[model samples]
Target: MLKCDFQYQHADFSLNVELEMQQSLLGIVGVSGSGKSTLLKNIVGLLKPDQGYIQFNQHILVDTRQNIHLPMHRRKITLIFQQALLFPHLNVKQNLCYAEKWLAPSERKFQFDDIVDLLDLNGLIQRKARQLSGGEAQRVSIGRALLSSPNLLLLDEPLTGLDVQLKQQILPFFKRMKDELNVPMIYVTHHLEELEYLEADTLQLNHGQLQHN
Candidate 1:
């Protein structure tokens, strides 16, 4: 579970969002510049809120009133950006293995090989990041994130760049991750159709607020 009640200000723009998530998937639909990504960044400690708090499960991540702010690396959180953002010099397997190095064997919830199988990355293992197609790269990216065994996953418009065919192909993998892996996720997107497939608890972000969609 996750709870965030924060007010963040960046020069002329501001974001005030408060929401609690318990479901496996939580979707936030908003137009560009509507503060969806900003909310996520704050949650993961990439950006500290000017005021308010964030708590994950029973742990406090940020509580400005108490001067508590957990660093991004210590949050046990993983963020997948709009772009695949894989390391260009690393092969698919190497990129995936990168996450494992940071975690102890016991701390990991999933095996490396299982992630490869689930994400359909067996053949792409030897391919360098640049050699992958958009969809392939995204799949590898997802595999890499899952391999880390994050307590929470944050995805920001992950399928935005892919064509409809590719999106359709990748959506099922996400569904499988939700249903089979049961990982909790906060998915932010401009597309409502994507949420329909995930069956997420849907919310809309409009002018610094959150409401049922």
Candidate 2:
């Protein structure tokens, strides 16, 4: 489970949110700059809260009063940005292997071949990261994150730049990742169509606050 009650301030906006999420896909919906991405970043430890706490499975990732703040790598949370963000010099397989290094030998839960198969990445394995199409790159990115065995996956408008056809192509794989892999995810998007396909519980953000129905 994940629980958070935190606040952060920016030059133009302040983020104040409290939310409790269990082991399931939880979708965050809001307009651009409504603090949705900031919330995810905070939970993932990319940003520290000015006050309050963040707990995941009883681990206190951040507690201002206790002066506890875990770094991003130690938190075991993965954030997938809107862009694929693959290493331009690395091949697809190399990118995936980069994350695999973080997993303990005994805890390495995912097989490389299995990830390739799951993401339909066989044909792109040998290709340079720059050679892949947008969809292919994003697939590689997702596969790489999965190889790391993250406890929580934060997707920040992953499908934003894709065309409708490409978005449709990748949608099934997201479902496969959620259902077949059972990796709890927090997907941030403004699009309701994508949320419907996820069939996840909704956490709506408005004026920097999180509201659930």
Q: Candidate 2, after superposition: displacement of residue 184 in Å?
A: 0.8
lDDT of each: 0.93, 0.90
Candidate 2 has a TM-score of 0.97
| Residue 151 in model 1: lDDT | 95
Question: Which prediction has the highest TM-score against the true structure?
Answer: 1
Candidate 1: C-alpha RMSD after superposition: 0.8
Cα-lDDT of candidate 2 = 0.90
lDDT value, candidate 1, whole model: 0.93
Model 2, C-alpha of 20: deviation from truth (Å)? 0.4
